[model samples]
Target: MTQDAPRRPGRRQAMALGAGLLTAGALPARAIPAADVQPPRYALERGARLRVLRPAKFIDPDEAIFNENTKRFTDRTGIEVRVDYVNWPDMPVQVAVAYNTGQGADVVIGFGADPHLYADKVADMTDLAEYLGAKYGGWFDLAQVYGKKFRTNQWLGLPMGGTTSPVVYRRSWVKEAGFDRIPNDLGQFLELCRGLKRIGRPCGFALSHAPGDAPAYANWLLWSHGASLTDEEGKVTLDTPQTARALDYARAMQETMVAGTMSWNGASNNRAFVAGEIGLTQNGVSIYYSAKTSSDPAQNAVAADTEHAEMPYGAATKAPETALTLNAMVPRYTRVPNAAKEYLRFMMEAEQYDRWLTGCLGYWSQPLKSYAESAVWSSDPKLAVYKDAMDTPFYEGYRGPISAAAGAVLENWVVVDMFARVATGQQRPADSMREAQRAAQRWYRG
Candidate 1:
């Protein structure tokens, strides 16, 4: 176990750590398919070898199926491919080093706005993107948002699917709290938490600087209240009345949480929920997956009681926001760009992609629409909520374009810090908003 990134998302500032350059939608029931578009063909380079860097497999089966698929690709093309799985936090660092040095992995799979951060340094993927989108019934809106370079509309990355943070909870506990279902209204949602708290089983949302869970909670709180970090022009516009209101709401909601959530990391809530210490929390489907596949009787019982739901809107009633979007890109320095791109395409083909998706056990939501018909979604009723992750509003930068600066804001944990301060009683709503505003301006204005 080499400290694999456990679907723990977001991250600390990569530019500072690596010392490098740093840097919607929905609808339509049936996925749009290209009836006549043919997938692009590529000539494999003789004796070509490729190394792909991606976040370590969070689930064991994901690794198994992926490796098996890689072998299939190698067997078919006679090109060797080496897939290196690393921690999520290391992804940006490695990506930065690769782009800076013009060596290392030929292709890299990274999370959240990474493509845009190195858009200029990566190979042009427009043709590949178009081919995949056409053959696979089209990429979801959020996928397109992350896959293409904003100003030029050039494809910077291949849209790989991502892990989604949904509301994972105990069905029995929710019913005990007097709610057969999670409410879409924030006010009613708060009351449900209050009831859970009164029963000595409080809801627990991460308030720490966790890479994934903390930002998931923070962004949902802010966006659901109509608060945004920047305008469409990318100007810092964080200090707003709506943001203050979101902070206040967080303060109120804090009362219904477990006492130590302010210090919880990405894995904390999962541990607490399975241990029967917390009644509710936002998380990937990993907890349920673990419990379902575990040998322990108590864990199995926990799995039986588990369920997943989408996060509710606050006053804004906007579409829910997601925690991470994964992408794959080829650096311009790769000696075998064709081999790298071909590897990506081969893995994304329906046959391999479908198998990989099924093996993931619903932990990953597909970026392309055709996979919506995958059995993984219908295999377990609880998994249905995650299948629509691509339909949620694109959240990495929010009202602004996804830029290196926005990545800096996220890596800096500005939003997470703001919400945590209010929830922990360390600062008032207005003070936290002001602090967040100043923090975001430092990056956006630079």
Candidate 2:
């Protein structure tokens, strides 16, 4: 039931942490068709300067295009911007601190359900979100689900994009194991893992407290098995037969995983897969990207063998959810709200966003439906698997509204722990389900 104590400062103060910053300078603006782009008018404050915080890039082009676009925004407008890139896992903590202290970035690109957790502390982005959605085809259903405040049209955040956490596997190894592709059936998937294990190249999914990896699989495991932490009414309903089946399934899968996966973090699987340690793992395109772009010949060899497939489905009979979205919010504590909004507006416009989308190489799927046509998806057939990530079910608060309670449950890693306990044999399926029920109820009933 605990939340970050809101120490809302009355006046804005300069943040002293200056490392890992890309300061925007006056640079030449790239030409875009004036008729194609018409942004809303915003009267920026005098000497308006913005500080933005976003996740560090998994590949060079994502950062390069973003920095170039930021410069273009600065070039188009006279406002100065300072962008800070932090590790992905650190985004939630940093954003929490920023809102609490009112001394970090004015505009933050945070993780899933973050805007819900700090809704009151952020500016209403409904105008901006609506404008962009109208201009583009429209935001995806999942984007709207994560962007808007609970039971209201007010937008607490703008959906930036989501990473497609597909199953990254070795093509040769899987074929050698006698499976042409990763199976959609839960039992078949487990058998595939066992086959991979027998060949000494076992699969691994983060079972530890990894911010991205743990939840990606754990949430998928829950939804794929027709279980959820809460029902549509936001009631804690983790203790169920469906949930027990999932826990038991996870326990069986974990038995076939690589040793020490119980202690692995977000980056562990990527490193392991690239090193030929694991035959299969769930991750974004970062692993394949790094391998293909690496200077080492051995890593490049691994890249040739890399392939991707969407996560399998179980009792849900559909693609399971993944925790991969990144959201943008302008904290109300900012002195220059208009300038902050303008910056996001400028960045999202197609002239800039198209390049950024193409530059990301399919690691990030578009929130807007129109961006689905970006060349990144078609540039390589291997990347096509990630093209519709945002269209899939997302937000760990499935079957219920994404509230602060859901955010708290995710932040506490309750779901990850519940699955990990069963997977590691620390608790039986029933015991883990009961423990998770008690833990989730404390938040839902708070």
Against the true structure, what is each candidate's TM-score? Answer: 0.90, 0.91
Poorest lDDT segment (10 consecutive residues) of candidate 1: 16-25
- lDDT tens digits by residue: candidate 2, 1-446: 00112222111101100111122121123222234545678899899999999887766666767888899999999888999988766777898899999777889998879999998899999999988987777888778888998788899999888886789999999988879999998889989999999999899998798768888889888888888888888988789998898888898898899899888867788878988899999988778777776667898799899999988888775578563787999999999999999999999887777767765666667898877766566557988888888886556788889989999999899999999998888888898889999999999889
Misplaced by over 4 Å in model 1 are 1-36
Query: Candidate 2's error at 81, in angstroms?
Result: 0.7
lDDT assessment of candidate 2: 0.80
> 28, model 1: CA deviation in Å?
17
In model 1, pairs of residues that clash are: 9-211
Give the Cα-based TM-score of candidate 2 against the true structure.
Answer: 0.91
Q: How do the residues 277-386 of candidate 1 rate in per-residue lDDT, one tens digit apiece? A: 99998888778876776657788899999998888866555456674777899999988988998999889876677777776665668888887877677667888888
What's the CA error at residue 93 for candidate 1, in Å? 2.0
What local lDDT does model 1 show for residue 56? Answer: 77
Cα RMSD for predicted model 1: 7.6
Where does the lowest 10-residue lDDT sum fall in candidate 2? 11-20
TM-score of 1: 0.90
